[model samples]
Target chain A: MSDSRVSSVIQEWAYSSQAHTQTLNPTTTNHAGSTSQLTQMDMIPYSQSQGLVRGGTDDRVTEQMMGLSYLPYTSSSCLSNSSSTGTTNHHQGHPNTQQDFSSFLLPSLRAPVNKRSISKDSAEYRLRRERNNIAVRKSRDKARRRILLTQQRAQHLQEENQKLQMRIGQLTQELDTLKHILSQRHLHGAEEGVAGESNI
Target chain B: MSDSRVSSVIQEWAYSSQAHTQTLNPTTTNHAGSTSQLTQMDMIPYSQSQGLVRGGTDDRVTEQMMGLSYLPYTSSSCLSNSSSTGTTNHHQGHPNTQQDFSSFLLPSLRAPVNKRSISKDSAEYRLRRERNNIAVRKSRDKARRRILLTQQRAQHLQEENQKLQMRIGQLTQELDTLKHILSQRHLHGAEEGVAGESNI
Candidate 1:
């Protein structure tokens, strides 16, 4: 086929890609309307140890791991709501699935080494790029969330540390007062020291 | 080249690949002799917010984000130590970096659609596969580390909760003891109420 024909075919592929996405993501399509249920589950627990991310059945973790805000754009409205992050492209459909691979083809993205660089024009190359992009984003976001959650955890621990210190202070002060009272009574020559007066 | 010559060239490429990796990983090599210092830093904080993972400066996070056990296998002994996770490849200059993509070519990995499968026999195709493999592994290890860290955090929080609960119990018991003693003294017709006796 000539170059013009290939370009025309590419345009056709671009338009129908949305419809094709439904097929590419049957699992996601099945998951479309059930986001509300996933939201409820997210509120309960989202533990990988709990087997929340089983293979094939749903390699996807609980929506909590991905964050409700980052959950797949199961609908057009949800897509718009999550657009600000620009990280939602590969959220199991929602069109433009190839954008990651396409964007990755930045003219400046030569390999880190100096030997002959690889070609960029093959179908396998394109598909590999697409998957790599998806996985990379997924990985990076996972890292970011891990850091954020840890930060939150550190904050909580710090607060708890402060509270525990304060409680110890209060208890120590109260103990000091009680001991002082008991000692003062002894100095005043009461026959009964606090111990002697106490009937156990 | 003839088929036999091609096979010989492939062998040569494999051998020299290790030497070439040093070029691919100048940053990681610079980090090689300084791992002990990085270990000391690990005992402190490992926050992304603190700019611990500045791009290219050190795309790597703290040695903590990756457990010290998993810190790039920077030495030969370290490589053996990390053999169990089978994830030590792509740690800047490890050999056999093509495994992920090579493994990805399993016949079972045909596209999810009915379209003709992509051609996988070009130089660019192989390199892209190689890089994609590295990225996928990097991404996956990151995720595993994330889940593990969260698990550790959860365990620490649970332990703290139990300790706090025990502490509250202890405080309550002490308060009850003090209250009982005061009440008994009052019943014995002490002139001073415990509260009035306690001058702040």
Candidate 2:
């Protein structure tokens, strides 16, 4: 398959996983909750194991080449295909073409291949899921912290506003008292002048 | 008058001035906005001047001793009474008591004493009112600044919240892609395994 097709497949897988996580925790997904449209394709046991081996190896090489180090786990096929590709490469130099044919049957000759591969694929899937879950949790925690900090700052600002209002009140009261004293003195002076004039 | 009565008078003057300030700016008086019930008392001119002189000096001394440096200006009577009291004291110690008495008579002796005193009182009132107006404007400006700051901070917090929400969406999408890839590989492996079994 072309590189673009492989990347598109991986992108589809990530989208599916995000949907699964949302289904697991519906409450938290209220903000950007959207139903995943990707359907689950059923697979036969043997093809599932083989596909796991091929896709895992291909995804890992593609991710590494693309420098996507954040995706910690390689594709499921990487572990199985790497040794097989190495063996095939080594056998390519052999003159005995019949040995190479026998080598191609080696996987079938192993009685426990299906069970072992299936178990391995299951384990890898579980590990990748765990890592994705951790990343989601971390992002959520960070968002929550930011919200809390902002709320605290808003509360502090409100308190400061109230205190300033109180200060204005005190100053207003002081100014009024000063004005009253001045007016009182003026009135008193006027009255005394009138009395003095009447006596004269 | 007793020291207590003098202090009471000063206190009443302070309270009256505070009431006047409240009346001038009715909007900001959230705490003591009730109408002042303190009645204006009539007084002889000599006593009015004496009270002004005493109250002015006492209030300054009290405010200084109390460390109330924020109150920049003294009681209203201070400016007018300070000059009058100085003239009275200088005349009191003169050997020509009769001449000093004539000088005291000079204010009452003048036909325009009432008009001149009224003009002087008006000028002082105008100056005091101007100062009060400036203080009110300053207080209002400070309140406006505080309100503006709070609104800006609230806007900033909302923007931050939006950015964080966007980040969460991005992270969710990334996580979903990773899950989809893992599931796809598992399904592919199963299909290959079933095909192998059917061939066997």
Q: For each candidate, what TM-score against the reference?
A: 0.30, 0.21
- lDDT per residue for candidate 2 within B60-155, as digits (tens), equals 111112121112111111111111111110001111111112223333332232334422124464454445644654453443333333334544
Query: Tell me, what's the RMSD of every candidate?
Result: 18.0, 49.3
Best prediction by DockQ: 1
What C-alpha lDDT, on a 0 to 100 scale, does residue B187 get in candidate 1?
62
Q: lDDT scores for all predictions?
A: 0.38, 0.30
- What candidate 2 gets wrong by more than 4 Å, as runs, is A1-200, B1-10, B13-129, B187-200
Candidate 1 per-residue lDDT, tens place, A19-80, comes to: 22322222233233433333333333344433322333333344244333323323222111
lDDT of 2: 0.30
Model 2: lDDT of residue B17:
35
TM-score of chain A as modeled in candidate 1: 0.36
